[model samples]
Target: MKNFKIIVLAKQVPDTRNVGKDAMKEDGTVNRAVLPAIFNPEDLNALEQALRIKDKYPGSTVTLLTMGPPRAAEIIREGLYRGADNGYLLTDRAFAGSDTLATSYALSRAIMKIGDFDFILAGRQAIDGDTAQVGPQVAEKLGVPQVTYAEEIVDIKKNKAVVRRRLEKGVETVESVFPLLITVTGTAPACRPRNAKLIMKYKRATTISERQNVSEDYIFMYDDRPFLNLPEWNVGDIEAEPERLGLSGSPTKVKKVENVVFQAKEAKVLEADNQSIEWLMKELISNHTLG
Candidate 1:
């Protein structure tokens, strides 16, 4: 079997699901500093798919590419602990406040720099901005075919990939050739746990910016093991146009943000019986909560 070069697009996003009082700023923007950062959930699914491919094709390599703050290198290390061969962090102040379109452009440029990847895998959407546009937008910018809502990469033959996609009402299978982009969905299998050995090996992985803060004693380890240095690229490194970056390139604007709180007025207790279940379902359907 021919080994493949796969790039997994990942992200470090604010944990919006567990929002607190300090989640938003006075200017209607998210207060990411106050919120906990985590690996995007769907992106983990994408990583699992890439790792599966690498496992099936022994010589294949899984590389992770993420765009975020310098601290985002944490995700790269997380990917390394979970079977990725190497990873890159696209970090720079120039990428701040980027909308999906601008974000995709930056990622596309980075991918071009990496070069020769057979596939690009990313999450269908990010929790921070539930817009499922980045993956497809990156594909469009790179001029590659894209498959969204992918649940599984069923097989590969003759440089073609067979992918199973999840749909609202059903599932569909499609085939596409190499140099394709796929957006994995949460319905896919969860990512495997971090390997103990891999964790120990990659625990010291750090990008240049991160290394700068390290104590002098541990600095030599990074130079000794080059793999411990995760590549961190900025706008200049990727040769991106200055005007088409950050807020300058982002056209989307949020006019207002309102915090909503829901309170139950009443509650009813019922036995865990078939009749109760049927009544609950009927009530939910009647209220348009379920159908």
Candidate 2:
């Protein structure tokens, strides 16, 4: 039909950028087990952008794709509950510890397997790694044009789309052809809150294995009640290129991570009085704390 198929790429990362005591191995690769995982914030923004696009184009559908451990399926289901038409997980032991370059390889391959798509949306950068490289890199792999740090989709037609993007000191509006990639920024509008109706209907949404972890009744109840169940994709279903599906296909690898500890001493209180303030100012100036 050549209609819109929006694919949003998301990631699950550590809650805080501060690595835990055992968060990283002697090698730079992340010891994910030691860190608490959470969804990437900007990716949520990208999801919202896709949803908005669907709202504008009546027949459009949104699909979310992620490359991470199996648990990342949770984010995919979460995307479905938020009104995405479908969710796909690109997971395999072979994809573990992939750097952005490698990770993009896996995601791009899975995306290609998904057939026709109108656009690829992603967060400008993961909170854990502020490099803002993956989205553009994925676009490169897909050989599609990309609009980075996008703030909004200003306009869209069957064959082209326009978007506003944030630059370091300014902004630029772009018009790119369909099947393009777009990476959004936090400055983009926040996603609409979860629709309670959708959540209640799709709350139990799970992948085949995810449902296996629980009682059959649970999944049955949701599936029977379309309002209760949502769609989720598993690894084998997407027909990804096996050699390109995991870590082996990736070129970049994490070497190690060293936590830099900056200790703070006891706090000192300073009076608000003018003379005391002057003394503190002079001391700060002398110590180069202030110019």
Candidate 3:
């Protein structure tokens, strides 16, 4: 089989586990610093699946792609240490607070610019937004077949692929042509640990400011280290339609983000005695809390 060019979409999101009231901005945007930064869970799973494919296909390549601030480059280097051949950091101030539509537009154009892609893989949803639109939207923009909520590969060929997809009740098998986009679900395996040698070699790979932080050891480890830095792309990187590349390109807008505070509701006690229990059951049934 010929080598395949696979692109895996990854994301870095705020660590919600550490989120506090200060973690949100006045406009409801996440204060990424207040919350720790971490890779999107499902996206890491997607990377794992792509790496598995590379292991099976000799000479195949897995290229990780992500859209976020420049600091997002950390995970790009991390992906390389974990077996990805290359990565692209889509960074631009214009892309701030982008909904899924804007994100997909930027990604689709970048993928086209990267060229020679036989398959595109993404997590079914991003932890930060939880919107699964980007995967299918990229497919639509690229005019290729897509299989979403993919769980397993049942069959593979040079010109086509067949996969099992997750559904509410059960799974369904779907087939699509090459150059297809796949949105993977958490049902897939997790990302494996990085190779020891690659970690030693590429962990120093970094973007601009990252170099400023730990320059001598990490960024200047080798005479040729600078060559590996990812080329950060802005709105100018691709021939993207202006209206489709940023806030203007997005149709959806967030109205508000309420901070939900849980409070206990008044409850009536149910006695353990059968007669009282039966009466309580009847009352609960009448109130629709029980049947």
Candidate 4:
């Protein structure tokens, strides 16, 4: 089997499931500090698919890519624990406050900088944005074929990948040529648990900035082992235009955000008989709730 080089795009997002009263700011933007940061759920599934490919093909490598704050380095370490070979963190204040378009543009430039990859895999969408546009946008930017909502990557051969995409009604199977991008859905297999040995080996992995802030005791250790240093790329590190990154690159802006709540005001108890059913149907039709 050809040794495949796969890149998995992951994200560190606020744990929206445990939202609190302070989850949103007065300006209608999310207050990320109040929420715990976690690996995006669907991205984990994408990592699993990449790991599976690595396991199937000897000498294959799985690398992760993520763009966020300095703390986002945690995403890379998490991927290391879950069998990824290595990862890069794209961090810089210049890349902050990016919408989906800007985010994808930065990611594409980073991808180009890394170069030479058989596949680029990512989640269908980030939980924070839920736009589901980055993966396709990256594919377009790179001029590669893309498959979204992928439940499984069935096979890869002859520079073509067979993928199974999950659909609302059923599942679809499609073939995409190499240098393609795939966005896995939550329906894909869950990521494997962290490996104890891998954790022990990579627990000390840190970026240049992170290392500077910490104790210097491990400086010699990491210097001796270059792989222990996770790559961190800033705006200047990639060939991205300044105007096409961060807020400037973003074409969309949030004018306002609203909170919506649904409540039931009334309920009617009815028998499980034909007459009750007919009456319920009539009421629904009359109210235009059913067409």
Give me the candidate number with maximum lDDT. 1
Every candidate's lDDT: 0.94, 0.79, 0.83, 0.93
Worst 10 residues of 1 by lDDT: 253-262
> What is the C-alpha lDDT profile of model 3 across 1-291, one tens digit per residue?
777889999899887766788877886567777777788888887888788788888899999999999889988987898899988888888888678888888998899889988889999987777888889998998998899998876667868888889987999998888888999899888889888988877776776556567646544453466547776788888777777767788798877877555798998776799999889778889999976
Ranking by lDDT: 1, 4, 3, 2
Residue-by-residue lDDT tens digits, candidate 4, 216-270: 6778888788879999999999978999998899999878777654786777789
| Runs with alpha carbons beyond 4 Å of true place in candidate 4 | 22-29, 261-291
Which sections of candidate 3 miss by over 4 Å? 17-31, 213-223, 261-264, 268-291
Candidate with more favorable, higher TM-score: 2 or 4: 4
Worst ten-residue run, lDDT, model 2? 227-236
* lDDT digits (tens) for residues 1-291 of candidate 2: 345789999998877677765776675566767777777999999999999988877789898888776778788767877888777776666666667777776777778887888899999999887889999888998999999989999988667898999999999988999789999999999987777877775667665556668785565675465633323443465555556544665666656656555797887887799998999989999999999
- Total clashing pairs for each candidate: 0, 8, 1, 0
Give the root-mean-square deviation of each candidate in angstroms: 4.8, 4.1, 3.4, 3.7
The local distance difference test score of model 4 is 0.93
User: Weakest 10 consecutive residues, lDDT, candidate 3?
Assistant: 218-227
Clashing pairs in 1: none
* Tens digit per residue, CA lDDT, model 1, 1-291: 689999999999899999877777776567778888899999999999999999999999999999998999999999999999999999998898899989999999999999899999999999988999999999999999999999999999897999999999999999998799999999999999999999999999999898888899999898799999999999999999978888899889766777554886777889999999999999999999986
Model 1: lDDT equals: 0.94
